[model samples]
Target chain A: MALDADATLGEAGEFGLISQLVAQLGEALTDDEHVLVGPGDDAAVLRVKHGHVVVSTDLMVEGRHFRRDWASAEDVGHRAAAQNLSDINAMGGTARHLTIGLAAPADLPVQWALDFARGFAQECASVGATVVGGDTTRADEIVIAVTVLGECTVSPVLRSGARPGDVLALTGRQGWAAGGLAVLGRGFRSPRVLVEAYRRPEPPYAAGKEAAEAGATSLIDVSDGLLAEAAHLAEASGVAIDVRRDAFDVPEPLVAVGAALGADPMQFILGGGDDHALLATFPDTASVPAGWQVVGEVRDGEGVTVDGSEYDGPTGWTHF
Target chain B: MALDADATLGEAGEFGLISQLVAQLGEALTDDEHVLVGPGDDAAVLRVKHGHVVVSTDLMVEGRHFRRDWASAEDVGHRAAAQNLSDINAMGGTARHLTIGLAAPADLPVQWALDFARGFAQECASVGATVVGGDTTRADEIVIAVTVLGECTVSPVLRSGARPGDVLALTGRQGWAAGGLAVLGRGFRSPRVLVEAYRRPEPPYAAGKEAAEAGATSLIDVSDGLLAEAAHLAEASGVAIDVRRDAFDVPEPLVAVGAALGADPMQFILGGGDDHALLATFPDTASVPAGWQVVGEVRDGEGVTVDGSEYDGPTGWTHF
Candidate 1:
C-alpha cells in the first residue's frame, strides 16, 4: 500500500490516489464517534445530536485563490478548510464534518494530493471535525470545493440580528493576510509572519460560540475585510455601522511591513481579506468577550462608515 | 432585477450575478421549512428531523464530465444534481438540501449561469430538496461541485451488508446513457430518447426507500457501469456476484443503435454507466420490491462474473 514518491495522479490512478488521501486522514475518519458511515460508500452518514446542522460551501481555484509557487499544497488545503470552517463559526456552530470535491490535472503529483489531505485533516482535528467524504475528478486546473457541517447547541447566530446601539467587536488576525499578499506581490518574503498568515489563516474557532453564548446580536466571518463585511452586516440587519479607525492598534510587524512597502497599514485592517476574523455585535462593550476588542458601533442609519464619514479605499475583492 | 440576456458574468459583476441566480431559485429559497436560513448568509441552517444526515459530494469538470457543445448548461446542471441526489437515494434517504460550488470563466454568459441554477432547482424540486447555499468564483473552465444532504427515516443502507444468497436487483435506466454517448460519439443524433437520456438521467429515487423497506441487504448507485459496481459490491461485502446476461432485455433504442453501429447491445446493458441506476442485494427473491428487476445473485466467492464467465469489454470510466 506504500505509494511511490515519484508517482503522479495519472500514475497512481483515481482510486489509488483516493486511498492514499483517505489514509492520510488516519484516525479522524476511523475513530470519529459522530460518523455513522465514512468514505467508500455512496454517501456518508453523520449523527447530528442537536437536530440542527449548520453547513456552507466555498470554492477555491488555483491562481485565483492561491499559487503553488507561493504556498505548499498543505497550505492550500489548510486555507480551504479554514474558510469553510470560518463560515460554520460565523453561524455560532461547532464544525463537525466536511466533504471536499476536488478537480485537478492528471499530472498532479500524488504526494501533493496526499499532503493536501493531511493539512485538511489537521485543520479538522483542530475543531473536532472530520473529513467524512469527497469526490475527485480531473480538470485542467486545480479546483477545490469544500463543504463543512456543524452543530449548534443554541440557536445559530445570523447576520441579520444586529440592532441599533449594538457594540461591534472583532477577534482573530485582521490584516496580516493583506500584508502578506502585498509582500508577495512585491517579491519580498522576509517577513515570514505575514507570508505565513496568507498561506494558512488561523481563525478564532472557539470565539464564535463564546460570542453566541454572550448573547451577541449578530456575527459574521470577516473574510472580505472589516469595512466590506461590515457593509454586508449593515445591509443584512438594516442598520448602519461606524468603525473607529483609531481603535485598531496595528501590529508592529504590519507597521514595519507598511513602512518598508510604502503602504498604509490601516487600509489593510479596513480593506484586506483572507484573515477569517470573527466580527460580532454585542448589546454593549461590557457584554463583549474578553478576547474580543470593541472597534465599531451599530447605528440606525444605513451603510458602513469610518469615523462617521465615507473614508473610501479598496474595500474588498470581487470574484467576477 | 432584470438580467440582460446578452450580459456576461464579468459584465454583470459578482453580487449582481448572484442576486440574479438567487432570484432564479424563486420560492424554493423562501418557502422551505427545513431551511432556517438560506443563501446571503455566512452559512445555512437545516433542521434535520431524524438527527441523522446522509451526505455525499461529486465534482464535474466541463470537458471531463460534460461538454458544452453536446449539452446545454441546463443539462449539465441537471446531470450534476442528479448524480448527487442519486447518492442520497442509494443510502435510502430523502434528499432535503443541496449546496453547489461553481467555478467558471468570467466571460460566461449570465443567462447560462441563470439557466444552470434553474435546471439545478428543477432537479432538486423533483426530490423535495432545496438549494440552501453555494459559492461562486472564477476558473479557466467550468467546474461544478455538488453536495447533497438527506434525512433517513430508516437506518441508512451501506454497500458492505450483503450476504451470500442475496438477490441482486436493479432499478431505473441502466444503459441508455451509454447508448446516448455512443450515438453522440459517431456524429449522429436521430434517436432523441437515447440522447436525452445521456443529457438528463431519471433515477428511480423512490425505489430506494422501497428496497430498504423490503429488507434489502446492501445497496449501491450503479454510476460506474453495472459490472464495475458489482465488483465493488462483491469486494465490499466479501462475496461474489453473478449476472445473468439473459436477464437483460435491451430497450428498442439501444438495440437499434447497436445494430446501426455494429456493436453489441449486451455490452451497453452490462458495462454502461452514468444512468445512476440503483443496484441492491435483497435477502431473498420474494423480498425484492415490486418495481425492481432481478438481474443477478450474490454468491459465496469473490469478484463479478457474467453468465459464469468474464465478459471482456470496457467496464467503466476512471477519472485519472
Candidate 2:
C-alpha cells in the first residue's frame, strides 16, 4: 500500500488515487440533524426546512478559460464565484452554500490558493453565500469547478414562458466587456467603463427578482450576446423576436472603444457578451421596473431579426 | 452573423462564440407555471414544489480523469453520469435532472459526442434521471463537467451524525476494484470478477435509501478506502473509531488477485477504494439491514484504528 514517490497517477491507478485524495479532506459535519451522512457514503445528505433548493455551476480552466498573466488569483476566484452566483440570481433564488473542486499543479504556491479562497469568500459574502465545502487536488493546470446551492422562497424564472407580442426588456448595459477585451488585446489603455466591465461583471441580481415579481413572462441572462439570447428566447417560446436598432442606447464608452478599435459599436451592443444583463420578456402593458429598458418585441416570425431584417454582422459564439 | 468556416473561436471572440452556440440549443422547458423566466436574463428561474432539492457535481478530464484508449466514448459517458448520480443517492435524494458542460478539441469526431450523449441518456434512464441542459465548448482535452439535480421527499443523510457508541456497518464488498485494477495492470486473465469490478462499479443504490429509512446514525459511501472513510466518519462525528479486522469478510476474488500479484490482501481490503459501498454507523441495538455487516465500533478516541492499532497502509488518494 506504500505509494512510490516517483509513481505517476496512471501507474498507481484511478481508484486508489481517488481514495488517497479523499482521505486528506478534513471532515467537519457532525451535527445529527445537520448532516445525515458524511463523505464515505454514496451521497451526502442534508436537511432543509422549506424543501426548495437553488443550484448553479461554473467551470474554470487554466490557459483557455483564464490566463495567469491577465488576472490575479483573486480576480479569477471572484469572477468564478460571481458568475455562478449570478446564475442563482437568474433563477430568482438566494445563494446559501457552495461546494468547490479545485484542480491545480502541485507546484502552485499554496498562498495563491489561499488568495483564491479569500476572493471566493469575498464574492460569496457579497451575495450572502458561504463556502460550505470543497475538494482540492493537483493537476497539469488549474480548473475550478464550483456549484452553488440556493434557497428559493418564490417561483424561479425560466426561459420558456414568453408569449407572442411580449415586450423584450434588458436590465444593464452590453458590449462593455467585449470592448474591454478589444482594448486589452491591442495593448491599449482601456476607458474606465470598459476596464471595470472586464475586471468584475456586474450581474443585475435585484433586477432579476424584481422582474419575477413584476410578472415577467420569460427571462435569461445576456452572458453571451443580446441577439444570441434573443434567439434563445425566440426558440424557447416558439416565437420570433424583432430588435429595433434605434432602441439600442449604446453607452459612450462602448462607442469610444469601437472608435479606437475600428469596430462598430452596434456590433458590441447586439453581438457583444459577458455583460450578465438580465433580459426578460413582459406583457406590453406590464409596468417596467427601474433599470430595465425596452429593447425589442416578440413577433410571429420564428427567429430573431434586427430592424425588420436579418442581422448579418456576426451571429455570436459557438463552443465548437 | 455569418461565421466563416476558417475562423477560430478567438477570432470570433467570446461573445460571438457564445451566441452561435446558444442559437442551436432549442427550448426544452414548457410548463407555464414551471418557469417564470428562461435563459436570456442574468439567470433562469423554475418553480419548485414544497420539496428539498439535491445537488451534486463531478469533473472529468481527458487524460487524468479517463483514458480515451481504455474506455470507449460510451463508457466515459456512463462513468461520468454514474458518479454524479451516485452523489445524489448519497444525499438520500432521487436524481431528476442533469446539466453537463463538455469541453473538447474541435477535431474530435462529432460522432463521439453523439455517442457520449447516448451513453449519458442510457445511464440516466437506468436511474430515472434526465439530461436537462448543458454547455459545450472546445478545449485541448475532453473535459466533462456534470451537475446533477435531485429531489428528496425525506431528510437528506449528512456525514455529521455518528455518535459515540455507534456500531459501524458496511453494505457492500471492498478492495475488489483495486484488486481488479491490479489484475488488469499485470495482464492477468484468470479472474473475471476483478476485471468487472474495475469496469463498472456497483454502488449500493437502494441500500442508501433503506439506511435512511432505518434511521442510520451516519452514513458515507466508501469511495475512498475503508480505513480512510472510517477516519472521515470518526472525524466528522468527533469520536474515535475501531475497525475490527476479524469482522472483515474479504471476497475470494480479491484474495486470489492479491495472491497472484504477490501483494497483501489485508492492505487491499483496508486501503483499496472505489467499491462505492454504503457505510453507516448506527446504535449498537439498532437493527442491521440485510446487506450490512457490523465491522467496527465508535468510541471516545479521536481518530481511526484497525483492531486497536493504527493502519500504516496507503493513506488514501491525494489529488494534488
Most lDDT-accurate candidate: 1
Q: What is candidate 1's lDDT per residue for A1-320, written digit by digit as tens?
A: 77785799988888888888778875777778889999989999998899898999999999999999888999988999999999999989999999988899989998889888888889989988999999998899999999999989988889999999999999999999999988998998858999999999999999999999999999999887789899999999999999999889999889989899888899889998899999999999899999999999999989999999997688888898
Give the alpha carbon lDDT tens digit for every residue of B1-320 in model 1: 67795898888888888888777775786779999988889999998898889999999998888888788889888898999999999999899999988899999998899888889999999998999889899899999999999988998889999898998999999999999988988988858899999999999999888888888889998888999999989999999999999888889999999999999998887888899999999999999888799999999999999988887887788889
What would the TM-scores of all predictions be?
Answer: 0.98, 0.83
Clash list (residue pairs), candidate 1: none
lDDT of each: 0.90, 0.69
User: iRMS of every model, one decimal?
Assistant: 0.7, 4.8
Docking class of 2: acceptable
Candidate 2 lDDT: 0.69
Model 2: per-residue Cα lDDT over A201-221, one tens digit each: 777767777887888888887
Q: lDDT tens string, model 2, B19-84?
A: 543343223333224444333434433445534556666677776656676557776777778777
